[model samples]
Target: MTDEEPTRSAPPEAHAVSPRFAEYTDRLLFGEVWQRPGLSMRDKSMLTCSVLIALNRSQYLSFHARRALDNGLSPRELSEIVTQLAVYCGWPMASAAVSELAPVYAERGIGAEDVAPEPVPPLDADPGMELRRKAVLDASIGAVSPDLARYSNELLFGDLWLHPELAPRDRSLVTLAAIWAMGLQPLLDYQYRRAFDNGVTRDEISDALVHCAFYVGWPRAMAAAMVAREVLVGDDGEDHA
Candidate 1:
């Protein structure tokens, strides 16, 4: 990742301020971990960007957006991600992410219309899972705010998640990143478990946690890593990867 602009990935003054931390950030995080084989660099970029957006860390978003573009995630696809995340991560941060990205798009002469995704029926047509989610929502938050439940069940899952813009696996990865980056550990078990259902592998989850360590900070990433271990690797001592 060659970032012309300063990003959290490789901070310019961190080395002078904290040499060892910087070395580990560069050599260990990027050098060794990122070079491992499971997740593509493109997926890493996308996940990182999503986490940053979720955490409202827009300062670093543009740099990673460039890396995402370099790694083959198209402008339209990114726009799609922003739209999806607006539901899951909230509209303001999603808007902030696009705020940084729009200039990158304009620099390349990519118009808003050019990046808009073609409409489609909701692709998340899993009735069984949909019903299960609604049931859970109804039992919990629905009792408090019925509208929230409807928006979550009827819109987020019924509509946005079903969209074909982002693949199920990619969507799962970014959603997991958002939950993890925000230090929302309770959601980790649920998201990590569902990630497998969405076709994200244990190894890829491992890679993602490591990737998040650099971008979101170690505390958030470490807590998420432990939760992933519990969720992905149970008492059988299995190498499920």
Candidate 2:
């Protein structure tokens, strides 16, 4: 962000990035490629967040986490993405990402010292959907791997889902997109139902999946749509009954 820092230059070789790697990744990749066309820097940063979290790139996740905030994403939103990604990308990565962010929060003055006492609770929002969401997650992932199932519940649901910054709708969208991009079809199917349980509309979920298709691929989008149809059917059945 400083003038002295080269905005479009390759990452330093001393940082273990080879000159060749720098050409493709740092210089051309970020500088020329990501900068080329229609997308704004803010949108690019959000995309970067999705990719980094999907790849479990802890170091880049930290780097881009700060950039995401600089581009207008909040700490709470970043936390939510990391938490949601844990369902697909795994928790060790999320933990590493949270570790990467602690200092950034300190520097940004996010704690009590920055804000006066408000009468409202820190997390005053409705949390009722959480229990229902757990049932969906339990059913979706419970039979798979215990480690994955446990992390999805304990860390993502218990910790990040409770963050107050981003709305549940936004959080669910990010979760759905991340899982979709990661090609975790089963989890995506489960999260499709859970997203509705958290009050996300079928239209919003459909739109998000559609928007992500170009980046994530038609196959993944089709799979997500199939799952979403099931959710809609289930809702209709409940309504008719």
> In candidate 1, how many Å is residue 233 off?
4.1
Which runs in model 2 stand beyond 4 Å of their true positions?
1-48, 56-71, 95-155, 233-241
Question: Whole-model lDDT for model 2 versus the true structure?
Answer: 0.64
By summed lDDT, which 10 consecutive residues of candidate 2 come out lowest?
1-10
Task: For candidate 2, report its TM-score.
Answer: 0.54
Query: What lDDT score belongs to each candidate, Candidate 1 first?
Result: 0.80, 0.64
**Going through the candidates in order, what is the number of backbone clashes in each?**
2, 0
Q: Against the true structure, what is each candidate's TM-score? A: 0.86, 0.54
**Candidate 1 structure quality by residue, lDDT tens digits, 1-241:** 4333223455879888997787676767676666667788888888888888888988888878888899888788788778877877888998898789878888878896777666766564777877887899899999999999888887777777777878888889989888887888987877886789899888788888877787778898889888877766666877443
Ten contiguous residues minimizing lDDT sum, candidate 1? 1-10
Candidate 2, 6-103: lDDT as tens digits:
35355566346465565555444455555544544554566567755665666766677778888877665666666666655777767877777778
